[model samples]
Target: MALAIAVGLLLASGTAAADRVPLPALVKAHRGEACVEPLPVIRRDHMKFLMHQRDDTVHEGIRGARHSLVGCIDCHAAKDDAGRWVRIDAPGQFCASCHEYVSVTIDCFGCHAALPTVAFRKTAE
Candidate 1:
């Protein structure tokens, strides 16, 4: 009976550990030391910031490079092993990896481009 109980405990603990799998490492930014804000701040409030920025751009015709989605794609999008530019929604890329880990579905790419705009790309170059 004692041996059976010990085996059950071990199995339960193993299951718990499996349920607590660590999050994948975040992909690196293409420029600078970190994101626009501190890591924790961005992790928590990025959607809020993005929403506000989007409203301003779409309704008010105000555009700011620092907070625009184009800025994000320009800095976060990276080249894959084959030298092709990876989209933000690609697995292990900037946006997809974190969104996948958190189980959040982003619909921004449904209408907006996931890659940076041509003007942004040229300016980056």
Candidate 2:
């Protein structure tokens, strides 16, 4: 009976660990840019594209939350100094803007660098 209880406890602990949220890795390198920096650049079409990408289970997963919790809008959905839709600094700021109100500590940004520049690549001649 003691052995069975121990096994059950171990199984429960393993299940709990598996339920823990997983964070994505940071964007350390980008298109040959060693010191990849964050930039705010928002495009309507790009936003829509991401919306589609997440909503599409074939590409991501059911509801896409498993693939990425912060769909494009979660970070890129903001207005600029000119009152135009644009990405924000620390893209984590966008997340914190909401999470702070709820007093939630987010570790997602630890491994994942919150930068608007993470999405695209520039081609130079």
lDDT of each: 0.81, 0.45
Following a full C-alpha superposition, what root-mean-square deviation does model 1 have from the true structure? 3.7
The residue-by-residue lDDT of candidate 1 on 1-125, one tens digit each, is 99999999999999999997766886677666768888779878989989999989999999864678878887788777876677889888889998888899998998878875543454534
lDDT tens digits, residues 1-125, model 2?
Answer: 99999999999999998896433333222133221123332211433444555567546555644224344333444444674434333444454554444465656456544544333436311
| Model 1 bad stretches (over 4 Å) | 1-21, 118-124
Looking at candidate 2, what is the lDDT of residue 18? 84
What candidate 2 gets wrong by more than 4 Å, as runs, is 1-66, 73-79, 82-92, 117-120, 123-125
Error of 2 at 87 (Å): 7.5
Q: For model 1, state the Cα shift of residue 74 in Å.
A: 0.8
Residue 9 CA displacement from its true place in model 2, Å: 55
- Least accurate 10 contiguous residues by lDDT in model 2: 28-37
Pairs in clash, predicted candidate 1: none
RMSD of each: 3.7, 16.8
